[model samples]
Target: MSFYLTALLQGLCFSGIALGIYISMKIFNIPDITTDGSYTLGGVVTAVLLTHHVSGYLILPAVIIAGWIAGGMTGLIHTKLKINPLLAGILVMTALYSVNLTVMGRSNLPLVSISSIFTSLTVLADPNQNTGLILLVFVIVITLLIGYLLKTDFGIAMRATGNSESMIRALGVNTERMKIIGLALANALTAVSGYLITQFQGFADMNMGIGIVIVGLGSVIVAETLINWLRITSVWISLILVLAGAIIFQLILALTLSIGVDANLLKLVTAVFVLLIVSLPRLNRVKD
Candidate 1:
């Protein structure tokens, strides 16, 4: 039960990444691999600030700004330099590795000795339960904010830019500008995951963001599956489904571990699981 509970907390921590991916991949139709780098950047920034005795709430803006800059760089590279979006993301992600290391001044920074945002809350007696409750609130607020954004005029334009770039451009919408802004927003959200996860795990490592985009991809794909199956057109309902997908993805992994799968093979399991999720829909259509 405790194990499953921990997974639930982790899924909540990862809500930012799922939403980020939904923006980049679902909204903008860009794979935007900058997620791996910006995520570590968030954790790096959070760790540095916390060790300096900065207030937890104060660190959020810093983290978001840092993420925004990283994402903006990728957008600029892709739009201004005429680079492929994937390559631009890869370039920024690679650069962020060194940036994260320089920010940390080491390979790892431990936060267990210091206070965390989770520690500040005292509503629940059990620390785990308290953390879970706080995370639930955090996820809800973020989801609501995103849902509202997607229903606005700018948001509609952003979605249209993705759905029909040529058509929107015909209407005088600068498709390139939209792509840049969309990527920037996506990575900023991704960085928040790093902020939350570093505090949750009580440490920040330079390598923490390695291949992390897969988690977001898996979650978004899971949500995408449901969105298709239910024909969900409401943006708010789709956002809620994305949150559910993140939780469900983590729970599946937890179940795998509980059934005695080798911990070292977990990545392999994740890969296979994602492949199945990605393939299943196509297989169903083919059968019909």
Candidate 2:
């Protein structure tokens, strides 16, 4: 029971990343790989700030800014330099590795003695429940905020720019600016996930974001299937499904581990799982 609870909490921590991926891949149709670096950037920034006695709340905006800058760099490279989006993301992600290491000044930083956002929250009487509640609150707030934004005029413009760049550009929308803003927003959310996970796990490792994109992608893919099947039209409901997908993904992983899967094969399993999700829809279309 405790193991399943832990997985649920972990899913909440990762919800932000899933939302981020949904924006970048589903909305903007951009394969933004900057998530890998920006995620660790968030953790590194949080760990460094916490160790230096910075307030936990103060770290949120700082991590968001850091992630925005990283994402904006990718956007600029792709738009201004006329580079491929994938390559631009790859460049930024690779650069972020060195930037994260430099920021931490070490390969890993443990936060056992440092205060965290979880430690400061006093909402729940039980310490065990406090962390989960706090994470749930954060995820809900962020998801609702994002859902609201997606319904605004600018948000509609962003969606249009993604669906038909030339058409939006012809309509006088600055498609380049929209892409930059969208990527920045996506990465900011991804950073939030990194921040939460670092606090939850009590440590930040330089390699922590490795293959993290797969987790987010898996969650988004899962949500997409549910959205299609249910014909979900409401923005809020779509957002909730994405969050639920993250939790479900973690639960599946927990079940797999409980069934005695080798820890060393976890990554392989994740890859196969995502592949199946990605391919199943296409196979169904073929059968139809």
TM-score (all chains, Cα) for each model? 0.98, 0.98
Number of backbone collisions per candidate: 0, 0
TM-score of 2: 0.98
Off by over 4 Å in 1: none
Error of 2 at 84 (Å): 0.6
lDDT of 2 by residue, 65-131 (tens): 9989998999999999999999999999999999999999999999987889899868888877999
Model 1 lDDT tens row, 56-151: 889999999999999999999999999999999999999999999998999999987798889986789999989988889889999988888889
Worst 10 residues of 2 by lDDT: 119-128
